[model samples]
Target: MRKVMFAMNISIDGCHEHTHFNPGEDLMDYFTGLMQDTGVIVYGRKTYELMVPFWPEVAKNRTGRPCDVAFADAMTRIEKIVLSRTLENADETTRIVRGDPEGLIRELKQQPGEKIAFSSTSLLPRLLEAGLIDELYLIVHPVLVGENKRLFDNFLVPEKLNYRLEYTRLFKSGAMALHYQKSE
Candidate 1:
């Protein structure tokens, strides 16, 4: 079985929404490189919709961020999976998985690959409850939300899960990427 991982960029207060990248930083390329090693990309319907268009177009707009364009090409090469309830047709190329998310992920674990990833905080706790995700790759932004979207937004009891810090890097904006694995 491959290492199932969850990669997400969130604000200090843990908001997974919004487009945030400081000047002189090519965040998309940074993330795309991560995807290059991934055989599959999975996301909540919202994240898929938000990224689908940009990923393709970023390739064409190699105006300044050359690496970003390369990243776009990398994104186009990978398989994309989306978890949605009401989506009828996700782009012709995207795989849409409806019904029980936990069951689907559990099934994915049985497949041949390094791992599967999910990019939704909304879905993270459920994955945790099911004990599916093996690790987490989180990009923690320094900006705080006095009141905004939360990362641990679910009814997850904090004490139930244990985290083993994997790595940390501080960016110029004070943002950082904190990787953690669930200690079983």
Candidate 2:
């Protein structure tokens, strides 16, 4: 079975607003590496809309820094699954899935593939509650955005979910990449 990995960038204060922090070259490279290793990426409607046109355009035009371009290229190569009830269509590489995201992910895990990555903050709570995430990568940035949606804003698990830290890397930008595996 493929491992389900949940990755996101968060502020020291737990804010998950993407625009709040600018990822440096090292951080961008880190993300690129993650994308390279992932076979499939799952996003919510909001994240898919924010990423698709922008990343695909970047990949096509080869704009921005080298790291950015590489990250965009990697993003464009991966298969994407968007879980949204209202989204009617997506690009060729993406599939718009409606209803029962948990079930869909569960089914995906049973199939042979590389790691499945989750990139949507809105769906994090649901995924955690369902105990579907096998690994987690939290890129904790140094700065704090005082007022933004937090990483666990709506997470209300009945019991604690445990994870063991498997790896940690600190970038020059002061952001730290923390990799954790779900504890047995």
Candidate 3:
């Protein structure tokens, strides 16, 4: 079974606005590795709209930094599954999925693949509550944005979610990549 990994770039205070945080080369490289390892990426409607146009442009023009370009290229190569009730169609590389999110995700996990990655935090709470996420890669940045969207905006877990810290990597920018697995 493929692991469901929830990966996100969040602030020290738990803010998760992509525009607010600037991913340095090393951070971008880390994301590139995740993209390369992931067979399919799951995105919510909002994130899909935000990334669909930008990453393809970066992939085509190679206009971004070396790390950005590499990340973009990797992103373009992977399969994308956007779960949205409003979105009807997407690019050839992506599939638009509607209906029960947890049930569909369970089916995806049973499939043979490298990994199924949850790239959108908006979709995390539901999957986390359903106990579908196997691991988490939280890239905690140094700065704190006082007011913004949080990583767990509407999270409501009945029981306390236990996690074991798999490892940690401190970046030069003072940001840290924290890896955790859901404790059984």
Highest lDDT scorer: 2
RMSD of each: 2.3, 0.9, 1.0
lDDT of 2 by residue, 31-92 (tens): 99999879899999999999998999999999999999999999999999999999988999
TM-score winner between 1 and 2, please give it: 2
Question: Alpha carbon lDDT of residue 49, candidate 2?
Answer: 96
The Cα local distance difference test for each model comes to 0.74, 0.92, 0.89
Q: Which ten residues in a row have the lowest lDDT in candidate 1?
A: 20-29
Q: Candidate 3's residue-wise lDDT over 21-89, tens digit each?
A: 888899999989888779998889899998997998999999889998999999999889999999978
Model 1 pairs whose backbones collide: 2-114
TM-score of each: 0.87, 0.97, 0.96
Scored by TM-score, the top model is 2
Pairwise lDDT winner, candidates 2 and 3: 2
